[model samples]
Target: MRANRMPPAAMQCRPHTGEALSMAASDARSGRLGFNRLQRRPARDRYDGLARFFHWTFAACIVYASVAGYTLTRLANGPVHHFLSQLNMSIGTVLIVLFPFRAGWKLVRAEPRAMHGVSARQQLLAHGVHGVLYLTMFAVLASGFLMVPNGYTFLGLFEIHTPFQKGPLTDALFAVHRASCALLAGLVVLHVLAVVKHQWIARNDVLRRML
Candidate 1:
């Protein structure tokens, strides 16, 4: 062995050559295994079916109630106005029943992961909007009940008696109800616009998760 030995420079180059061969072999193996296998995208998270159901149901109710509430204010005391008033109240009653379960579900369920490229500010704004929405929703329901001038039939099933008289207190509550409803309407519009921005402009398709 002493008779056949490599020079210092040749020995250094030998190891490098071996390393290069090893790297090439590794690349070849990777190619054989398929590029997609090495570069696969992670699955996107989505809201569960029940959560989607609750979301759409609330959306529809809110839209209808906003329109009806506005119409009630414009129309004079007549059969048409009275019928719409009852219908709006019925929807509000339904929302009151569903709110607890919907809120509880949100508290317990794990939220879907944010889509790729969503900014931190976006997440903050979303949380803030959702919190305000819940607050306004509760306000709308509570004030609706308190501002009722008299006992009324709920869903044509039973009576909802208002202990509070139509005085200063009820009048104040009506103001709160109107303000909360208006705020809620604006928030809903902003929410829809955000979804549209994500789905189309940002190429995020955020609405797909809820769907």
Candidate 2:
């Protein structure tokens, strides 16, 4: 007598059961035994600690410099106003020095991937904004340096004689510097709003990457 056999459909079902058991065993070995792969949370991309530090520090310096610049314009010409002007220039000088290091780090280190679901065009726009911010920052600082008619007294520590002559050229540069600062302020506001939108509206937690 022939041995009993399962129908073709039942035989096919048995292999599926075997496959499920095999997969479970494999998952157990890999430490994901019971979890559904589809339900697993995606991994998050994060900026390195040093990058985060650079970002926050740069932001703080920009904010302080902007506030000081605005305050200087409102104050009457006096010792207090002069001190704030000098402080603002000092902050700009510090940013000029720090920017190179930040750029170098970015060159050497790979940046984290864009947030999940962010389109390529959006990523490009983000990068373009960053490039503009950096360029505007340098332009503002450079023009400010050239605009010092008398000379620059860095934090009242030392006075450096003006390399460029005090003339209409320096006056023009001062105007350019002021305009650049205004542009920078606008860009910073936009940057903050973008982050907020991502964090709250989009629910992407993009701000957490920097933090």
Number of backbone collisions per candidate: 0, 0
Query: What lDDT does candidate 2 reach at residue 200?
Result: 93
How displaced is residue 48 in candidate 2, in Å?
1.5
- What ranges in model 1 sit over 4 Å off? 1-44
Error of 1 at 14 (Å): 51
| Candidate 2 structure, TM-score to reference | 0.76
What TM-score fits each model? 0.77, 0.76
lDDT of 1 at 99: 94
Q: Residue pairs in steric clash, candidate 1?
A: none
Task: Summarize candidate 2's per-residue lDDT along 49-115 as a digit string, tens digits.
Answer: 8888889999999999888888888999999998888888788778778888987897787577689
Off by over 4 Å in 2: 1-44
lDDT of 1 by residue, 154-179 (tens): 76788888778789999999999999
Question: Highest lDDT, which number?
Answer: 1
